[model samples]
Target: MLPRPSRLTLPSIARWARLNGSSSRAASGGVTLLPTQEPTPEANATLTEEEFSSMIIHGRSIYPPLYHPRTHSVPVAQLQFRAYQHQFLDLYMHFVGHAAAALGIPISRPVYLPTQRSLWTVPRGPFVHKKSQENFERKVHKRAIKAWDADPEVVDRWVRYITRHAMPGVGLRVTQWKRAPLGIGQQMVDSAVGQTRLGSGAVKVKALAEKIVQQELLVEENADTATR
Candidate 1:
């Protein structure tokens, strides 16, 4: 008779079974946190101590240390998108790609830098797993209350999101503007108008900012020639 499957062996078998069972369900590819193949000597070349230390501390991709230096050679401008909008970030990334395509900009080697943003992110909910509907609702209410009060967790998430997406785009957009100001300004203006804002007088400021962005009119060096 075959031996019974012990608990130790059961988990492995169960996991394998689940993976094989779901293999045909859909083709959602997985991300390998660890590299499958060893890095080549070129890729693994010794970075300076500062580079190695900083990269490890910040949880950055070690493979591409060339991005920052490259930015200097290619003009990079800084931009800030002040708010708590992850959805906007996703949409803006897509918009940037589409705009890049239209303007014949090369995006094959684009790098995203998020270390220089100034917003914070709060947790969406609790730490429970496979929670019931009631529990989920309670968690959401708690989070919502905390976020309303400007909870530290909420602030952290917002800061992280902006840091990662906005910084890189600042440079990218500035370069694009220099190449095609009229087109880029119009795009920015449309984006600013569609964006959500809060508080008294916020709407007016948003509109004004949109106009300035759309017209590329920051300094009034040629005020007489421009329409306000």
Candidate 2:
């Protein structure tokens, strides 16, 4: 049987209202259709027409785009996308993976994070009856993609392109890590000493900070090694 269509988005909800009689209980779903066209249906006896157009599907499908292997192994940046509807989030994420592949960017595997859920309870009726309480829940879906060994400029361009063509109801967050040269703190410490006779306490503090930074770099290297 073919996969069921998603009705989480506003347009899909609108389509559902149009297809199913609005007088039914499902009429609560709004009606909003997009300009894009759906694929033509196939001839199959096992699958009914209605199920092909609409039905309940658990663990929706996620089609990831291709990635071109590159020599760059360090993770330069990451992208986090979220939406109330998983369908929209996954669709846009798929598009981003493909766009990056087309540009020859080396991206890591797509990461699916846990869904965040919020709940509320209130009295169903005017009377404050404990037995007549109402409950409501809202869920936010999240997904992330990380690019490795790609040029910072290329990553910036990809981010801009995605922002310009972002879909409705989805939010994007970007984070980047800058690589620093080794032993760069020595130059700063020397310059400070030349400018003024710094006390031993200040120099000791600077050395301690530099040691912490070096330890962090080592931890990152260990983590990268483990992933490989």
Candidate 3:
């Protein structure tokens, strides 16, 4: 049997119906739109973490996602979601956090960034009242979720899964850091010349302060002995 569609899918299905000029009836070829199923309050309230996770995997959960405890604190990736509505954005991010946790990937508490507002004024007026113009404003809410101490492959899978089941009206952006090579001096050291990357410029620098200090002290001692 086919899986039941979630509440989030209702809006899009209705939109398609309208676009196909089918309002009180099914679309062309008897393509009937399935009614969205919303869980009752009792069921919603009694949802366990496992139940919620299953529903969320199908994009059908009503309650907010439960966050898992962080296992590792090292930040590996960050996810940011932007949407005009804060409720859906927050819900979607929490969903991602919960899924990552299921994969044993630690996640940080979401960071609530400032809402960005944009206002536009046009020459046209409301209802052809050209004498007076109106101003319209839009606010986009942003939230950031970070993955901590997670392997790159795990993070990638998490992202891929979330992308496949993306929530409507939400925009997702991901930022990930490249892993550094293992062991000491493996990242930027040249074994032959003993040089390392210094700053962002082309200037070459060596960290030999201790050796230089010892050489200067020995030179001073030699000078004193020669004077003696």
RMSD (Å) per prediction: 24.6, 21.5, 13.3
Which runs of model 1 end up more than 4 angstroms from their true locations?
1-82, 108-111, 115-228
What is the C-alpha lDDT profile of model 2 across 69-123, one tens digit per residue? Answer: 7585888889998899998997888778766865667887679999999999988
Steric clash pairs (candidate 2): 14-31, 14-32
Select the stronger candidate by lDDT from 2 and 3: 2
Model 1 Cα lDDT, one tens digit per residue, 1-228:
134333333333333333454453344454213323433444323343233323222222212322112222333232333223444444454444333332222333333334333334445556763242232221100000001122234334433453466533222222112334568888877677667444446878989889988676545546756764
How far residue 178's Cα lies from its native spot in candidate 2, in Å, is: 1.6
lDDT at 48 for candidate 2? 39
Candidate 2 Cα misplacement greater than 4 A, ranges: 1-64, 128-130, 194-228
Residue pairs whose backbone atoms clash in candidate 3:
none
Ranked by TM-score, top first: 2, 3, 1
| Top-scoring candidate (TM-score) | 2
All candidates: TM-score: 0.19, 0.54, 0.52
